[model samples]
Target: MSRAGLAAERTALAWRRTAVASMITGALFLNHAVINGWRPALIAPIGAAVAMAALAGLSYLRNRSLREGRHSRGGWVVATASATVVAVAVLAFVIEFTDPLP
Candidate 1:
């Protein structure tokens, strides 16, 4: 495998890790929501799912780039995915501060 391919694989693995974390967090949030209400669980899953999906998309795009020798798309996709993660984090914070729970 070339350097780009190796890098893409490593990034994909990292994305998987993020997905696992998000999944766990989402589960916890679901439990919290069940104990409380729909507000908490809904927000957490939305944020977590977005982040996981972004990471998945990024990894997929990067891997495709590596396979097709289109290295540039990898960078753009990674950046976009990272940005999405940040946005999700911000949403989580917003939910925490202004919880919709009653």
Candidate 2:
């Protein structure tokens, strides 16, 4: 594969890594929520999945642009994905740190 192809593959792998982590988070959260309550524990994983979907979309766009020989706007995608990841992490923290209902 060419360098651009390699780069696209790397980007895809990175996104896949994030998706796997998100899936793991969702599984853990769902399990805990089933044992605890459905409010905070369940919702955080939903947000993570949403972020993962967005990241996957971004990666797809990057790959498509590269394959089409277009100027892949990968930097913007990376930036947006990174920001979304951070936001989801903060949301997860808020859900985790909050006290359970009485």
- Give the winner by TM-score: 2
Q: Per-residue CA lDDT of candidate 2, range 1-102, in tens?
A: 888778766766665666566556555655655666666446666666666566666656665565566654567777886897788778777767784654
TM-score of model 1 relative to the true fold?
0.53
Q: Stretches of candidate 2 above 4 Å error?
A: 39-45, 56-71
Q: What lDDT score goes with residue 64 in model 1? A: 54
Provide TM-scores for the models.
0.53, 0.60
8-43: candidate 1 lDDT, tens digit per residue: 667656656655665665565456556666553476
Q: Residue 32's C-alpha lDDT in candidate 2?
A: 57
For each candidate, the alpha-carbon lDDT, in order, equals 0.61, 0.65
Show how many residue pairs clash in every candidate, following the order shown. Answer: 0, 0
Question: Candidate 1 regions off by >4 Å?
Answer: 1-9, 39-54, 57-72, 100-102
| Best model per lDDT | 2
